[model samples]
Target chain A: MTSSGGLRGYFVRSENARGFSLLAPTLILLVLMMVIPIIMLVARSFWTQSGMIETADFSLVNYQMFFEKKIYLYVLGKSLLISGSVTFATLILAYPAAYFVAFRVKKNKLIWLILITVPFWTSYLLRVFAWKLMLGYNGVVNSGLIGIGIIDEPLGFLLHNVNAVVLTLAHAWAAFAILPIYVSLEKIDKSLLEAAADLGEGPIRSFLRVTLPLSMPGVIAASLLVFIPTVGDYVTPKLVGGSSGIMIGNLVTNMFGRGNNWPMGSAIAVMMMISITLVVCIYLWLISQVKKRSN
Target chain B: MTTVAIDIRGVSKVYNPGSNQAVQALDTVSLTINDNEFFTLLGPSGCGKTTLLRLIAGFEQVTGGEIMLFDEEIENLEPSQRPVNTVFQHYALFPHMTVAQNVAFGLERLKKPQAEIDATVERVLSLVKMKELGDRRPNQLSGGQQQRVALARALAPSPKVLLLDEPLSALDLKLRQNMREELKQLQRETGITFVFVTHDQEEALAMSDRIAVMSNGEVQQIGAPTDIYEHPVNRFVADFIGDTNFLDGEITSVNDDLVTCRVGSESLFEAANSGNHSVGDQVTLFLRPEKITLSAAGDASRQGRVANIVYLGNQAAYTVDMGDGIELTAQARPREDGNLPFATNDTISVDYSARALRVLAK
Candidate 1:
């Protein structure tokens, strides 16, 4: 049994090696692309930068500076608020569309789903600029409103604000939000809805009590997909957000690019990631506890 | 002295009306279910029994005609506004709610007090023998347990009528039999009219006080189980309910209460006159297996050879072939010594009374 061929058999016959080898390609790519970059960022966050060069010595001065200057904290809080609002708005808009496709459309639902993702086939930046064109003072919306005689002058409040960023980002992430919600809603048994109606609940009450609760997993997935990425988005704000609408992402970009405070930028990025993770975990825990209590 | 709980008058439902794919799911069906009566709609699949039940439940709108509950027209009312609850097929228990919540849902929607809701939920759960599992989810229960919860949920609201849409088809045979008895008892105890729908004739005969046999979206007969079993109106009903042997004949004489018919080419048999035939009319005679008796004596009514024998547990079925190629099936209980009256290939004679034969128009 101790032959030379046994060496080749070791990897082929071993269950653990087979499993590990199957996953090795993805694991290596993930380590190089994601894990290694994250580790380096975390390491660089603790280093201090002198002039234009980074020092090897570890210090907490960047965090101290962040605390001393209240703008970073305000900007972070504002970014979180903006992302939260965008998540809520996007879900509210996507839910009815997804529900219509999932329950009301009896034939060719795949076509509707494809139509929803048609915007994604184009470049995301192009769509964001398209939103800019629509929300501009002399854009289609203002012209249509003026042509309809509803307004005599173009509205200046339509662009370069937090509202513009929320609107644009919600439109940009519509496809992401709708698909998961659609999948979850599709998984619910239609008989359950009929049972609800037979139990004396009106359509509205049935929706609140049965339909909404059953489709929550999809809602949670959609929220996470939109919320996490939107929090760190810099382009949307840079194009639509003016001086008063500057967010934490803009400050981080300035620190890394023109400000040349790489360590401070890394520290802010790390803090933002940790805070987002903490909020998501707390939300998940809260939902679980709520479900337990109801049960 | 009971009033009608539900009266369906000329109800019809047509799906995709006026389109190329249109289908008539139901056609002008009429029924009147008395209060506290256990009524069943028995038919094969796609025969519109479930469609009629849904019409009563207001899940589907009838294309024509009115449905009245307790003499009040409810055909146009919404399901939530109607005074009826359904124990759906497959026991559609809400997956997210506990048993107590599922039971309390209807009562809560009716705006009952919290104390009353809790009390009714507990009481109904106990009625279905699911009191101990009130805190468990639907996914955590067995099929029978889930069915009980569904019944308890429907019964908790104390609706005027309960619609059961093949609620026991998912259970094993033993559980289904047990639930059948329990359901009859529950219906009697609660005094609520139950409209059960199933395709099983045996289940219908065992459970219903009165049954309506349907075929191709039309009601063939509606009467007591014995009445329907003893006297099916047409060939479809006669063939659908139980096994029967048919013999083609021509009526030679039609008297007051008796009709003499020439069977096949030579034999003669008299059937009780149903007043629907005349002299020289072509007719089909329906005879049940148990009614035809096999005797070995040569002096019997008609002579035949035993072609085959089927050994049933308590009875034996013999297929007798009379001369002139006439075949008849007769069933007989085994004697005390476990012996059949006649064996295969033995010579025997078959005879049946005049009342055992049913003559239907061809």
Candidate 2:
């Protein structure tokens, strides 16, 4: 193997093959975990299903049923709205925290970073459960409000709603949103801020013109990181989402479980994946356009 | 004399006061910068020149005393509220903006009309001779181009006072020389008071109308370049500005116009009185290297052996060691025949006029 001879020599001689070899492990894992499963799902969407098991036959009945049935589209739309709201809320909350950590809190920055991520040290399920305990009807918040005489009874509107799901998801991924934003904000050259001030801009205007624009990449990254996962998140909606709060993830789960409609479930999964990919592409394109226009 | 543009009265800066890490960066330094004049604060690093500039620009607050811009006190104003802009050393142009946009930034802040902003941007860009490349981003331009854009951006606002903090220090040697002349011309055309801070003595002397030489935390001297160069007030001012030879001596006699100082035991040098030193006081006489004349055969005032000769293109500097073991450098222009008048290890007599010497109190 040390000498350049035979197979080793051929490997070293071909530049394309060398690059392929370097990427082979990741390529194989992606094919196994992602590509193959997606292909199977797409293929299954075109097959016929009797109850749960999909028959190996070519049919478009699942897609046909999707257009005929209105519930799936409603759930998908609701899921999108919830995901977007969570992304927006998470970003709005994260930017200030990230900005403070990046610019204001100078000493012990590492400690602040660790503290920002301290909530993630616990299991995701545990964090959701903690939120469940706080926001439940008879939870700490209601009891505290009742004890203070601010509320006559435990508020029924606190949990098991779209707002509850959004609040929980936003809190859950707060660290994910903050970390990337903080990294990008921290990378900005400090002299740029001073230059803006010297050019007759006040602190607020300088931040809007320089700081926010420079940190857009981080905001985009954080937005995608939180939005993509929460769109298909099953656990949060399952625990907190009531009947009206059920999203597309619950629909897919039901189709795979008691509904026993594998083809329909596969069709919905494929459609959801396609829609997400389209949204992300459009989002990235818009960010690039904004950056170009500013430049 | 021009009217005072910016009056810095006994301003000082102390960082992190009441803490163990506290530092006094500037002492009670007072200076009056004239309108339409190119004023420079020249000093080495840690000499508080930059701190003073920052205080004037309102980037830093003075720990004590007042700063007046014309007739109003400006020490309490914010940086943006003050009518001064700085050209940073690194030319901190906005990396995400085009040259035109960067130049228009200040005008836009002032809410100037769109057409007026465009005209002003064009005028300043062309003033700096960067009219064609206004569409390029800062990163797309070269170092010199970026520097010009920085200058254009600062000048676009037409500020009352321009503060340049070692602006040309980042450029190459050839570019630095060209920019110095351009900067002086710009200052003249704009007729704005310019407060430039630099550590390069040559740059300060070449461009500034008046220079304030600083050391430690105090202003050592302030005068025109020629005054500061020919007649420095003290040893620090003389040593910091240019090449000089200091000969230790004591004032032997103080006449009406001249003070005679005795060097070692045999040599006595006479110079005009510095007005501060009297008879019998210890003093050091400063003489420029080029002012001393070297001869082979003459009964000159002083004599030394040529220990080493540095051959510059037009002139050669002879390191002459006197008989008393004191060393002095004398520069001699090459002869028209293209032959060196003296060589290394040759015994030469050195003579300098009394007017060329400056006696400073030790």
Best by DockQ: 1
Clashing pairs in 1: none
| Residue B273 alpha-carbon offset, candidate 1, angstroms | 3.0
| iRMSD for every model | 0.8, 1.1
Model 2 C-alpha lDDT per residue in residues A66-92, reported as the tens digit of each score: 878999888888898899999999999
Instruction: Give the residue spans of candidate 2 off by over 4 A.
Output: A1-28, A292-295, B262-268, B295-301, B334-341
Residue by residue across B213-290, what tens digits does model 2's lDDT show? 999889999999999999888899999999999989999998877899888886778987868777789989999998
Q: Where is model 1 chain B poorest over a 10-residue stretch in terms of lDDT? A: B293-302
| Model 1, span B1-362: residue lDDT tens | 88999998998999999999999999999989999999999999999999999988888999998899999999778988888999999888888899999999888877778999999999999999999999999999999999999999999989999999999999999999999999999999999999999998988999999999999999989999998899898888888898898888999999999999998678888999999788999999999998887777579867888899999979988888887768898897888888887788898878888888989878
**What's candidate 1's i-RMS value?**
0.8
Q: Across residues A1-295, which tens digit of lDDT does each residue of candidate 1 receive?
A: 5776887688888999889899999999999999999999888888999898899688998889888889988999999999999999999999999999999999999999999999999998899899888989999899999999999999999889999999998999988899999999999988888888888888999999999999999999999999999999999899987776677889889989999998999999998998899889998999999988887
